[model samples]
Target: MAELPDWLRSIPPWAFVLGFVVLPALGFPISLFYLTVGAVFTDPALALAVALACMTANMAISFAVARLLSGPIHGLLHRRGYPLPQLTASTEWRTIVLLRASPLPWLMQSWLLALGGARFLPYMLVGAPVQSLVGAGMVLVGESLFQGNAVWLMMGVTAFLLGQAALTAVRRRLRRRGSAY
Candidate 1:
């Protein structure tokens, strides 16, 4: 809730971009980056592009961290009588979509999927776009608020609702099919 530091406001744009790519791994709130992008960038499309790229990079980093720690975490969990779920190929993308669409924080989703043995290709392919949609919505909403543009606000709201609706539809289908997430 605090305002960004004065220095942060003055940094070169490239530094902001670099921060976007690196800060989330250190527990910085990515939503801050998302919300701030609109105010910073002159072009909405460029803002959205940068936000998506940053989000994807953050996801990749989280996944790599999860991969590095997976063996130790898996062993620890097993010793404690808990085991991470193994995602089968058939259900992998579906799972990724669901988690990406769910309310879980972006970092958590990446970590969960990577820890669960999600393949890198599928994880990036399926998760990035879906998650990017969410980030795009945030960027839109941020831009709208910063610019006081009602149209962009509505678009952002619609994007968010559509994501939720898709998640709901997928869950219903899975339920009917007698499959559980």
Candidate 2:
């Protein structure tokens, strides 16, 4: 096992809680924290449990905030002569997931979906779990790093890459379908 970094070693529990909530909402990179948890803790299960909880909470809050800000943002863009395409209310779950999973910056995903009038249920149900898979892979990466095992590290990295590839494929398919009309 690896020694925990000094900052992470001394971090308080409340800090972890807050980081989980705020970091994702702000689109901050949190893999380090996830890695630290995986490295320092003796139990991989516990690390995963806490990491996922934080990720879920962060996604929930960020999604809600984007939803709340959507109207204002649209209005601002409209006034500035950049009218966004109004998404139909009948948008399907696949559409929502595909849009949310596009190859954009992390924070933009939330805003784009909210602006497109994505339903809260679908974002939570369809998008978040898939999104969290990446984070879970990240946690696994941390675990591997902590353990200093080449095989486990390679496996974790490969899984994360595969997940990324899958997301890219889904986004591309969605784009092609979207343009077919």
Candidate 3:
């Protein structure tokens, strides 16, 4: 909750994008970046957008790295007679969303989903929107808290609730689709 350095405030926009990608991709905690984006960006919506884009890139890159390693790990484990977890096609989206929204640390959630057997491209496509919706709420809340304003706090709450509702609807629809197929 301490003041951010004046230098941080002066950071270029692309640095934010790169920071979000590199920090999270390397397994550094990302909530702080989201929180910093929340505190720094004057526009809550814009902050969310930046955070979401960075987070999406982080997820894709980190997941890709893990996924690339997984093949070898899978082979080794299989040779040793271990069973890897598998994600059914229908439940994949639901699982991804739930894990992304869960209270687990960001890196943990990403790694779990990466290993859950969802197709890479599909997970990337579906995961980005869900991450953005939830991440935007977090940024809004962070913005409100940093600014110490009651009105902003209310807006943050509203944004968070709306995002959750949208995510729930998405999850339900995914389930229904899963069942139908």
What tens-digit string does per-residue lDDT give for candidate 2 at 1-181?
3345454657776787787778767877656666666644547788878877876777678788887887788899999999777556555466665654455655677667766777777777877776666667777788777677676677668867877787778767767878431
Which pairs in model 2 have colliding backbones? none
Provide the RMSD of all predictions against the true structure, rounded to 1 decimal: 2.4, 3.3, 3.4
Off by over 4 Å in 1: 1-9
Q: Candidate 1's C-alpha lDDT?
A: 0.83
Q: Report the lDDT tens digits of candidate 3 across residue range 1-181.
A: 5456344578886777788888887777887787778655667678877788788889888898878888887888889998577899867877777777677887777777887687887678877776676676667667777777777667667867887797678768866877531
Error of 2 at 128 (Å): 1.7
* TM-score for each candidate, following the candidate numbering: 0.89, 0.78, 0.78
Of the pair 1 and 3, which is ahead by TM-score?
A: 1
The models' CA-based lDDT, in order, is 0.83, 0.70, 0.75
The TM-score between candidate 3 and the true structure equals: 0.78
